[model samples]
Target: MAQQNGMVEKRGAGHWLTHAGLILGVLFIFFPIWLAFVASTVTQPEIARPPMPLLPGGHLWQNYSKALTSGINAPVALMLFNSAVMAIGIAVGKIAISLLSAFAIVYFRFPGRHLFFWLIFLTLMLPVEVRIVPTYEVAANFGMLNSYGGLILPLVASATATFLFRQFFMTVPDELAEAARVDGAQPMRFFVDILLPMSRTNIAALFVILFIYGWNQYLWPLLITTDPSMNTIVMGIKQMFPSGDDLADWPVIMATSILAMIPPVLVVIGMQKLFIRGLVESEK
Candidate 1:
């Protein structure tokens, strides 16, 4: 009885430490965002003042106005549209293609199946950064530059997402699939009716993650789309810097940056449940 009580005490202490660590981690992650929010409302001078105002200032509207109209660059609204297109395109494309591919990998038996899996899996290691110049050259050579295709097409398939979905699919019991098969279900029917329905949480989670990945993209789109009209919110943020006669305003820049974060933030928040479900499923 005494030994069991000692064991219970040890478990209680462990749980406390784990919960405390998680709270600290959450605070650490949110601190930068809180700082950015405070900075977004203050003037440049106020930002660098000897005593910074930790509180938010009242310049939000004025700063946003400056950011919205400062250049040949697309307005924040237009930039949001571009980002939305890219995000939705990549999200839909990656999820659809990867889902079907992962399903095939787990459920279907075919020639070169393992080879095909490895070939796609290899792409995760060879990121776009490694092939940036080659990809750029191909885009330039084919005259696919400066278009939505240039921005979205290269990212339509994600090896990481494919692997993630594949791993998750492998966890689903073959008995469930064989049960479907016995019901005269076709391949498409089994996938859409049985598999995908069961995978709804994971799919929604991956969608949010992929959408955020597209929205936060900076370098590739910047390299490809030279046209000002096609600028994404990220590119527009870059355009808000100091020029020969233009002032470099911190509040405006921060306002734009914070505004740029809204959609992805909302997405992550809304899909928090799905995200947790994916993590739990992956672990299982």
Candidate 2:
């Protein structure tokens, strides 16, 4: 009894320490965001002055409204819309293509199947940065510049997602495929009815990750979109900064930064449960 009680006491102490550490970590990460929110709500003088205020101010509506309607290059609302379209397009396109490619690789017995999978896998080494010059030329030839296709298409073929889906499909019992075949279901029907339902958590996980990836893209959008109307929120935020000796608009800039975070935050929060399950859960 004494030994077991000692073990319990040690575990209890460790548990408390873990909780305390987690709380501190949360505070550390959240403090900057809190400061940004406060800065967004206050006047420029408050932020520029020493020892910035910790509390939010009354200018929240004024700052955010100005940011939404009249940003430095383009309106925040328009940039947000452009970012949403790009993010959704990238996530959905990557998932769809990966699902089809992974499905064929796993379910079919075509010649060079392994070779094809390996080819796709090897492209992981050749990310967009590596091929940016040729990619830009191709997009230019296709007249995709300043378009959503240019923003999304060149970035959507995710080797990691393909590999993940292939691995998941492999784990699916062969018996299910056989059962569906015995029931006279076509390949498309089986995919739609059986595999898609099983892959919901995984799709949710990838959607959250890919959406953030797309939303945070800067270089690609900067390269492709010269028109201010096509600018994404990430680009808009950077553009909001003064180029020369001009005084920066701290409140509006901070407000734009806050607005930039909302969509990705909402996506992660909405899909938190499924994202966790997809990353950790093993069973189909």
Candidate 3:
């Protein structure tokens, strides 16, 4: 009885230690974001002074309003909208193209199919930076520059997504495909009715990742969008920095940073369940 009580005490102590460690880690990771939020709520002068206040100031509404209505270069509201459009376009376009390509690769057997799959896979080594010059040239020629198409089109062909979808599709039972064919379902009909439902969790997971990827894109948008109105929140934040001896607008910049985080945070929170399930749950 003493030994069992000792063991129970040991386990209880370990549990409390683990909780304490987790709380500390959370505070460590969250401190910077907390500082940013505090800064956003204060005035520029307050932020500029030494020993910045840890608590939020009374200027939350004012700073956020300023950021949303009239940012340094482009309005934050417009920038947020541009980012949303670009992110959604990239995520949806990548998923759609990847699904179709993977479906074709898995379901249809044409000549050099393996060769083609390998070719597509090999393009993963070539990121946007490697091909940026030519991609910019193409976009410029196609009149996609400074447009939503320019922001999304150059980056939408995701080899990673295609590879993931292809691997998933390969795991799907051939019996299902055979059953669909027996039912007189067309190729696309089988894809829409059968495959899409199975791939829902995966699609959710990829959407969260791809959406964040698109939202955080800075270089591509900077290269393509010369118009201030087309600037993403990332670009706007960078543009907010003072280039010369002038003081930076800490409050508004911090507010914009917080605003920039909201969409991705909302997406993750909203799709938390499906995202976790997609990553861990294996149908096969």
For 1-284, candidate 2 gives per-residue lDDT tens digits of 56766654657769899889999999999998999999999998887786888999999999999999988788889999999999999999999999999999999999999899889979889978788888999999999999999999999987888988999999999999999999999999999999999998789888778888889998889889989999999887888788999879989999999999988888778888865664454223
lDDT score, candidate 2 = 0.89
The stretch of ten residues in a row with the least summed lDDT in candidate 1 is 275-284
Against the correct fold, how does model 3 do in TM-score? 0.90
Which candidate order results from sorting by lDDT in descending order? 3, 2, 1
Error of 2 at 28 (Å): 1.9
User: What are the Cα lDDT values of the candidates?
Assistant: 0.81, 0.89, 0.90
Candidate 2 clashing pairs, residues 3+ apart or interchain: none
TM-score order, best first, reads: 3, 2, 1
Clashes of 2: 0
Q: Number of clashes in every candidate structure?
A: 0, 0, 0
Error of 2 at 157 (Å): 0.6
On residues 1-284, what C-alpha lDDT tens digit does candidate 1 reach at each position? 56667654646769789899999999999887877788887787897664768788888777777667663356666777889999999988988999999999888899999999989978877767778999999888888787888888888867877888888888998898888889878999988888888878778877777788899999888888888778888877887676777556668777778989999889877878876665555444
Model 1 stretches astray by more than 4 angstroms = 1-32, 42-53, 66-72, 243-246, 276-284
Looking at model 1, residue 53 earns an lDDT score of 81
Q: List TM-score per model, in order.
A: 0.79, 0.89, 0.90
